[model samples]
Target: MSGSFRGEVRKLLLHPYPKRARDQNPSREGFPIRPPLNNEPRTADEEFASDTLRRMNEVLARIQELEDALDDPSQIWPRLRGAWKRAEDEADPRMSEIVRQAREISPVLKDLEKRIRRVLRRTRELTPLDRVQEMDRASMLWLSRQPGRTIAERAGPAQRILSTVRYENFDTLENRVFHSYVRLAALVAREWQREHRQAHGSDRFRLVDTLRLRCRAIACDLEALGVGLAEPGTTPNYVLMQDRGYRTVRQNWVRLLRRERILDDLWAWQAQTWTDFAVLAIVLAIDELDEARPIAQSPIVWRQEAFKGRWFDQDRPLAVFWLEETGRIVEVQARPEQPGPLLTLARAHVSLRVTDPTRTELPRRIAVWTPHAMQRMDIQVGGEDAASRLSEIGQVASGEIMRDGLILTPAQGDPQHLVASRGKAHVDVIALDASGVSLALGMEALREFIRRDIWR
Candidate 1:
């Protein structure tokens, strides 16, 4: 019976309209009646099949309407309203029941909408990229809906931010600000280094002091923009503690500075400056530390660890350590152990100290020693002129040197001979090499070397 019903449905689907009049009228006048073609509708069964198919189609359409109403209960309101109006007009018996069902379902629909809104809000907060994508989709949908309006007139902030012209402007501004900071910092550091060198003699010039001056200068610049540093009593401190203005500006700056594009630019600029070496080193070190244990998990504890037993908390880990008599910077990672004394006896993974400044002539011979291996690798610095040779060496080393150490990989030599030089900034590396040499590379040459070789 089910199979027969399915066959009837298939026949109806295959030929929805009535058969041709000629095909249905198989018998001609005064002639013997002829049987219908196998594929043609038979006149005897045509009327009954068409009537059944019509009823079946009506039932299927009604079922689809009910399914749609169930899928979105909002559709039920209009349907119920129409049904109630029809019942009133026709004086139907189900009018009261229909009203009761609608009243019960309305609140459920409202609650579902509320829950959907809440979930969407949370999703937007948790996944910013999703929010951006959604915003773009919404803009496109809106544009399609209102074909009369131009995109510029209807575009949201997200759309504006994504626009080619606007994004290019934003990129340009970011680069300008970043380069400005680097240029200002380098200028200040150069002036301070010149004064210090003049006062204490070139041999006694301290990189840490020069760095402090540079940081103070940068902090001053930031303060001018009404963004306070993490430190207190530095500059004018325009951003008051716990002030809403400060919070707003600080949050904006944090978001801007945290962007990869901005940070990468800042890093490239820092690499170009000799005095900014400590700042770069500190940032890199903190980044390494944070990777070991995420700073977000315990920011307060991380701050304490970062600034423990140092000069100003601002320069604690890098510059402050360089100021010490030993000129050493040690970063430790403790093992799970038994006794307190055993913990004390454990050594740091990175233990670096500055050595005495060595004097060298115009074709200077510089050797670097790896801490573990204690093997020296000689670097060849030679050119047409002393200035060119120093420039060549600085180019080779460049941003590789840090406050704690310089990273060296000797070409065609033993890996053991590769070493780090402590308490020397990239500029210090150039200066130390050029100390006794006449017509040596100046600070500008070293800066150019870093800009050309390292930042590139």
Candidate 2:
């Protein structure tokens, strides 16, 4: 239920990057970043690394059910993966090479962009200063109290300077930061231009070209403003630590890189082909059932085993929720057909059915809930009636499952329209929302108790 419509479309690059909780997604070229709370929003044309691809995939998946009527749906990511597989089978290598080439240079581009930003911010906050040795009137007056005098200040001020003036001077970059900044910008600009040139299409890596031009423009702008590109100092810049603005921005910049944790809240949906409305229906059913209090006023009990295998590995999926409603215990699991450890607390803890992602049909993705008895013996853990339930478990090594015609999934059409006339029959249609489907399941599951003769 957790991983539904699990598509086999992970496009890996030559270099492996960590898929951490907050992924930078440096591989996705031209992916528009949905802003994190700590970061500034992206400009419409500017491209930077973020979870744009993942969010786009999520949005496309959500709208797949709505647009199911459309034929030849090749634009979505899941569909694209299928298309890629077909191409691979046909021995077509050009498309894959062209697309993945961008991934190779993206990490470099991202790091370059971050460095440029850091240098620019530090340059602004450092605010270059100059030391001017001068003998101004104010300096002379102050010097008169220095107990010097004795013709210390003669005409034309024969000495070097009466005093040295240490003041904030943006007038000349030959002083500290700006001149070195322009040189740094120019160095990065040349490298960026080289990277842009290596990229094939005119439009493909235009963002890199844009960044390259920006770097060049920064150097040109500073030179135009009467600042020479003087030699850079290798000395450590402790001034940045003192600047509150720089300190705050640096902290936020780090946080901004890692803050946006959710990939589902798409700013706007895009294309992808992954269908799992059945999974949603099952999950929604679980939520609906959990919220309702049983008529018998019995509390729900839950049990689970930790998952410790790699992705797509043969792992056990089990979560037991005991509902004592109408004197019955229901256990829910993704793998209900397989032989597993027995349920212990009481008898007949029914589990809602779930299956592997390879099964594309709705019935295979999920099954209607049936209040049947669980397996016995090695499958039976404990309980007073364990002896009786074992005999009913059949001569099978695995468990058994069934369906009761309950509204486990919602009908098609608007939820508002479906609400008024939903009481008529055991209706079936393509559902538009999960909430309506969930409500239907909650009510219908309760009704199944009285309709069945086994409990009587």
Candidate 3:
């Protein structure tokens, strides 16, 4: 995320990149109609959340607008009804409060509890007895021996006597519930941690980290209280289920489990399409549009997918960033599905819709990104022949090139793959590592070209 997913998908596009059109079979006697399918998910068993493009964007926005609630409980428990749902509606806070407690407050409480428990409060009583070390010296009974007294006690000395002792007592219901809740919290935190994928730089990671700390605190507090698993809470633990805050904790735990289940289903459904290429494309586009802000923030829908349980739109973008600079309303889109004539070769295209009443010309493709291989597989191609090699590959994929336009590709050693265009450019080829190209610089290059004839 620090890199803004920049050059990230290159891992996905590793090995030799495919032909732009998914055609172009090597010269053998056989002629093939279609290329082998490259439609597998980048990961075999897991799914990426950000891969859920456009759909979640609008839903989150709409929900925020309609409900006017930052954290909508209805989304968590849609069937929630009655005053129970409306509990403390003034603050409308029970659900969020519990989650927040688990997030930030629980951790501190647990830490304090653990530190306190290391030297827990104890009261002197005639119980929790240890070895008999001293006798009640003021009592005459110590001078007299009982009939069953041994010879050592009667003759040698009063060897031992029972006395009051002070020690920690942990057999309370409070201790049992503390242990139970801590373990439960740990389980929930693990799920959230996995969901975050431990990408610490991300906001998700920070939230998950806070929750993890809370879980640890709970465990330590229980451990300090000496709560063991062998102990049973045969009766209902009122401390965990009673009162306002305690009750909210239970509710939050259940809701979190439900959310995880739904997310699991969504992860399964993400296999329908390969949205990574375009997703990364959009990420780079935004990096270039750094100064410009989106017209409106995109909102999310809890469960919005083709199927009932899934989480996102497999084909549409995650969020559409529309930037209005001067008279231009630039809408950047990364259409992987609509890869023009280049089927899907880890390719991308950048075009513009400008309103100029004074100008009259068909909107031609401005910049064509035919990256045969994006990852820096061939560092060998960057010498005196780099330009010629680039031209040849580009021509093969998309016939002819705009002498004054841009064609960005992979050249790992070539900073941003910003290579100068030269002649024929026709019937030649190129293979640029388009992973880390400066999208803004490339776009500007096309706009401020020296030649007016190549007006794409």
Candidate with best lDDT: 3
Range of the 10 consecutive residues with the lowest summed lDDT in candidate 1: 297-306
Q: After superposition, how far is residue 297 of candidate 2 from its true place, in Å?
A: 18
lDDT of 1 by residue, 1-456 (tens): 011121232111111112232323332222112111112335645533333322222212222233333444434324522432332221122211112322333343233223211111212121222234444554455456642355544444443422111111211222223223333333433433332333343222343234335435544544454432232112223322343433333333333233323223322222112122222222223222211221221011111111111111221122211213222222312111221211112111112222222322122122211111112223322111222322334434221222222222112112221112222322122221111111022223332332222221
For model 2, how does the per-residue alpha-carbon lDDT over 1-456 read when each residue is reduced to its tens digit?
Answer: 111112322221122222333445454333344433223326643223233332232223333322322233322233433332322221221221112323343343344334432222111111112233345565566546544445333322334334544443343322224334434433433333332343435443454345445545645555554545433233324533554433332332223222222223222211101113232233333334532221211121211211111011112232222333433333333333332222211111223433323435322111222211111111112211233333333222334322221222222212211111112212122222222233244334433322231122
Alpha carbon lDDT of each predicted model: 0.26, 0.30, 0.36
Per-residue CA lDDT of model 3 for 1-456, tens digit only, reads 011122232222312212233523442322111111112234422222222211222122222222223256323112221222232122221222224545554544444354432223433322222353344543226436434455245433334333434467664554454455556556655543442342446544465466667667767766775776423323546654664444444455445445444434433332221232223333334434434344423343433223432233323333333444422233333333343332122233333222222435322233334332213333223322434443443554343232222343433324332344445331112232211132233333433331222222
TM-scores for every candidate against the unseen true structure: 0.15, 0.27, 0.35
Q: Relative to the unseen true structure, what is the C-alpha lDDT of residue 337 in candidate 1, on a scale of 0 to 100?
A: 26
Residue 86 in model 1: shift from native, Å? Answer: 75
Candidate 1, residue 283: Cα displacement in angstroms equals 13
Over 4 Å off in model 2, which ranges? Answer: 1-163, 168-253, 260-284, 287-319, 323-328, 334-351, 354-399, 402-456
Error of 3 at 362 (Å): 2.8
> Pairing residues by index, what is the TM-score of model 1?
0.15
